[model samples]
Target: MTLMASDTSADVVIVGTGVVGCLVAERALDAGLSVLMLEAGPRVDRWRIVENYRNLPPSMRLFHWDAPYPPKPWAPHLETRVAKESEQYLQLEGPNARAYLQGYVRYAGGATWHWAGICWRLTPEDMRLKSLYGVGRDWPFGHDVLEPYYTAAEYAIGVCGPSDPALQWPPNAERSKPYPMGPIPFGPGEKRLTEAAARIGMMNLPAPQARNSGVSYHGRPPCCGNNNCFPVCPIAAKYDAATALPKIEAKGGKILANAVVYRVETGEKNAVEAVHYFDPNKVSHRVTAKLFVIACNGIETPKLLLLSKDDRNPNGVANSSDQVGRNMMDQPKLFAEVELAEPLWTGVGPVQSSSILNTTQGEFRNRYAGAMFRMENFARSPLGSAAALKKGLVGKALDTEIRRLSACTARLTVEHEPLPLPINRLTLSSKTDWLGINKPNIYYDVSDYVRRSAKEYTVPRLQQLASELGATSFQLSPEFLNSDHIMGGCIMGSEAATAVVDADCRAHDHQNLFLPGGGAMPSGTASNSTLTMAALALKAADAITAQLKHG
Candidate 1:
């Protein structure tokens, strides 16, 4: 099929309008470079998403964080509400396929639209896992190199975190700058957990979050604690890409929504010359640029590369190493909930406010993966109320049950660091979407390292913590779950033979092409990876800026 004569041109062409892509656009545009961002999903407003959540049937609302933002036919993300329902879109196999059923939105701003806004930085030790622990591969650069970018990202997204150095996570990574604002006040549940954890020799610190704590920064209002952060922040308190698009456009960057990128075209020297995308009408349009960046997360970026095959490079663009969709990693997660003998009143503030930092590091990492534990701050109202009403309780009994569960129930979650394995990967499925693009087929499994960590350390520690909370009944999930922190698809390395991108996030085969974000991450530490992904994006932006200046 003949594509339309180069539909448009720009200094930089970016695929995926997620936080990483949008942040890069902001930096590139600020540096006076014209950028064209193509998003496969529709451009939705905050109000629309909030209304969608409100209109959902009461029963579905609790598990409907990613449901309200339905997938567009052209660009589908994993539908995780139900496995059987989502299988038609994402083909899953292997032992841990169910855990890989992630919850992410394809719309502009991507998954951050429904994220809890937690931000954790990797320690220098995390980057040197192979050198320090003899386990995973080491990053080309260390945490110190990314620290500046982390600081920049925190300010860019208006992160509020602890000012005390002791309270910061991954304690070994020194900070050059304090957070933009002081930490958000911990919820009642977090306070209770912190006290209980201290008695048992655990350290629970306030989590660094991207949402504004008090004073508004970057035009976003402060978080009002509406407790609807997952589906969508009722108000624009959290930093989502939607809040950045207008500013990006104000700086002359253009965004084309509902533009599904299908193929990447390479020219002389195997450099990325252009990309082909399908519009909402299924008409093909070729977009040319001097430089191109694919920040479509772990799955879609590699899928696009595999789809773009040619004689000069038959193994897919930038996949000379055959690592495009390989080494996919996520923090295998477990949840432990208990009915406390006393009311803890968990729904006081943001969804998640604090976590135990003690177990995230140690010499034990050489044998088993590390884990981070946190108290889920979601108010028990919606879930408890719904369950009570379903039990056929009328007025007084219903109110009593709801109050008891909402105030007394406490939850703890353990997120484990999983070692990267080439066998756990993503491929193109035989099934096709409305646009005829083949859906993604993924095979995933949590390594024994993580399983061992849960069995030996995290689970037992969590059970002890729950017991210390004076729980009447406590139970931990039997199986590992996906934490939604996707990483290591287009992994970075020093050698071109083993990695798709280099330390600078530039494709080894295509100098002008970059695949940043979590996809370029070489390691998945036990923490929320959004801040790390943003740091990598900023680091890549600096390299792209320098390349444009010299060339």
Candidate 2:
């Protein structure tokens, strides 16, 4: 694994080749800037991951979804499916340690490689949480400023959603453009749940997805109802950052894989001078650029900034305000397992199709955190077998019971939005990894706001929804889990003293450093933050373009 180091300079250099990083690199290249991307993890082929997933036994498929994508020693990521392995990567403490066991992989394509591809947009109400509800902090700008970028991101990612405005989430939110393609029709289980939810005055809307619906999009095939978006998507129907790598290269953007960035070098006027990285062999290399963007994961972004501490930035890069790793946020999740008399016949389409979007906003936010709900559409055959086997049934009785439970069981989910708190923080751990880099130590409390919401508001509503589904028996999961939507580490604000980045995601302390994507999000609305992250990436690119071209 011997590698040579040479001086490489570009107009803009980005760290992390995830969706957000790729989006920025693509835009910078399209704007005729020499763009270079440094990825800590090795490049993996999608087909190989798909084959690995297909080789798994049916019993292990659902449980070990991420087993196919093994972590390389130099580039390790948390695998929550295995608690011990997860703890070794991310040191977690606090009252809700299990909830903070964030599951993400370090690969050139980024976490999008194994994502559900559901893109939930933040509403105007979400941006103005403080003004309207007097609970959480408000965004620096309103939804109107971000709408165009959202639309652009949707088109770039090839998203498909319902054409009818009434069927869209936040039905009243104004849109800058229609969806790129029509939505995928709901399956039998989704249809039945929709009807039941409607009777209870809940609207289940089709979630905008990064997967192609019917016809092929951007040279990618359409989804064929495999219900296997997790782990791997066999065909390129779903939008993964890896799929954009070739296009980026075609546009003259160089991607250096297996190059982990550990430091951000600063120079005169507090501008980013260059970035130093380590190859898999621990060979150090210096990459200089006029401008730099570190689009690493929410956890890794702050960790990198903190790791880059120098004489000038003793607290950390962009930590003059001492908020680089503060305000950690994620959508806290709970589950409800229901047994119904009639078969829901789940797993007809994608792993997730629709969710109760209306519950995400309201006046109730003044008292408790708001929530969003969804019915997981993962194939239930394995769960059914596991459940039926526990009953001690044998022979034909076991087979019959499996069949009944497979079709009759449903898993409903609720994600309660968390307010940003400085206490929910990530710090450099004493523990070190293979590369001797400090592992991330996180302190997360689901917070009394989320606790009260689940206890007083969300739990009762979830039970009410379950009752409407005609459940013969229902059990609610007692513990809170992560939705894997990480946010707020590098929080954005208008003023420099209170926030790490500006609205455009430029680091407040460094003129040439822009930290975009999930880490820069101010508020983690009760939905997937992937779309908003992509939009922020694009918006940051626009700002970078203006600076480089106009100046």
Candidate 3:
């Protein structure tokens, strides 16, 4: 198939039609800028989405998994080098290491199609990590600067929650408006845990989720509370990028599906000129734009910039600082399952309904930790519940154990703060994809802080709580843990050497190129990254609008 061009140019061109990209497109259109969005997946339809979810293999039916689809011509092969088991403890290379991690949605709606809809705001201290804790570098701007944008994003997405004083951290920002909807009602399991946590001097509160509890302002229906949130939502109750695409289109923006962006093009002075993309048939096309925004996730965003190398910029486009793919970080997540002594009603509502703020503070403060416990209701699916029981009980005694403790299983989730490690990074591989563009080679490893925090600080406290809650037994997963909330790889800072983009999200070397996504986060916070990504996009959009008007 031959590649064809649409209208010659747009005011802004965004790559990746995921949650962040859709938010950026909508904001740009609202600013009266002509926008074009390129997605590497097929257009999504409601019926097809349901079918796709139903077809997923049972093993891969987790909330983060999306339906299988043909990969774009430029997509990388699923094969990669796996680190040896002996090297796992090296803190750099290991058997579980992922050579290329690409988790973005290929469908028109992106990953939001199957997300659990947990929305959270990064604590104020999250903004100045380097300055406050001397760990990760500080963001050029603080939470104060992002407060208004956060308000805008929450309202636009119809978030539901009440501000909890206990969960509030230092350097807090003011909210200009309230949540668009009310919070989800707490289930019996959550109520028991909340009461238990408070009895133990822990502050437990309802989780602020993006799942709608009532008619949304954006025309989507309320959530049906179908225990299945991952893989894909059969109903449009959860907020997804698709909901925002229509608003962008209404403002005259264009979204092109199955368009895989390869690399950015630069002019004589190294100014961003255009973005090159390959169609499903592997035919290359170029779209010129006054400005370009890379909303591709953490890994692909830097990979694209690195592959745009030329004689003028040997390292790559906007590589003067050599920080495009450095400082990679993902949340250090831990899971603990406890068998309860009584029936707490484990099969209702979303799995993660409430969280405790006690272990998140004090000596663990520097470690950056938070614990969220959901009633085992997430395991309502027969296959999922049986798997959990088997994994927890172990051996041929599993059947006897299931009958012995049928009503007593609850799970606790602990998300630890993962600081950005300069050594843990992303680089371009010599191997090229079908479009002749280099693939991304990710080098990620958990840090000592993450390991110690999970073992010393998080686990002990969780064990104490489980015992207090009358848990007969408890077990923890051994995976190092990667979160749906991927961040860094294109960190933002005041200086160019340590960061790729500036406080406003513009590339340090090329002012016309903006990176609006979790990739620009200086450090991964304990919250879901989608809401924060939208807020940052809104801030960047405002900056872009101001620059265009002034210039």
Per-residue alpha-carbon lDDT of candidate 3 for residues 352-384, written as tens digits (9 for 90 to 100): 656664454443546544434334456534543
lDDT tens digits, residues 55-131, model 1?
88876787756778888778777653454664467777898787787778788878878888999888888899999
List candidate 2 stretches off by more than 4 Å.
1-7, 57-59, 80-87
In model 3, which runs have C-alpha deviations exceeding 4 angstroms?
Answer: 1-7, 60-64, 68-102, 163-173, 362-377, 381-406
Estimated TM-score for each candidate? 0.97, 0.97, 0.88
Task: Tell me which residue pairs clash in candidate 3.
Answer: 63-230, 340-408, 346-377
Residue-level lDDT of model 2, residues 143-241, one tens digit each, is 989999999999999999988888886686688889999999999999998999999888899899999999899889999998888987778799986
- Summing lDDT over every window of 10 consecutive residues in candidate 2, give the lowest-scoring window: 1-10
Alpha-carbon shift of residue 178 in model 1 (angstroms) = 1.0
CA lDDT of 181 in candidate 3? Answer: 76
Q: For residue 529, what is the lDDT in candidate 1?
A: 92
Instruction: Sum up the clashes in candidate 1.
Output: 0
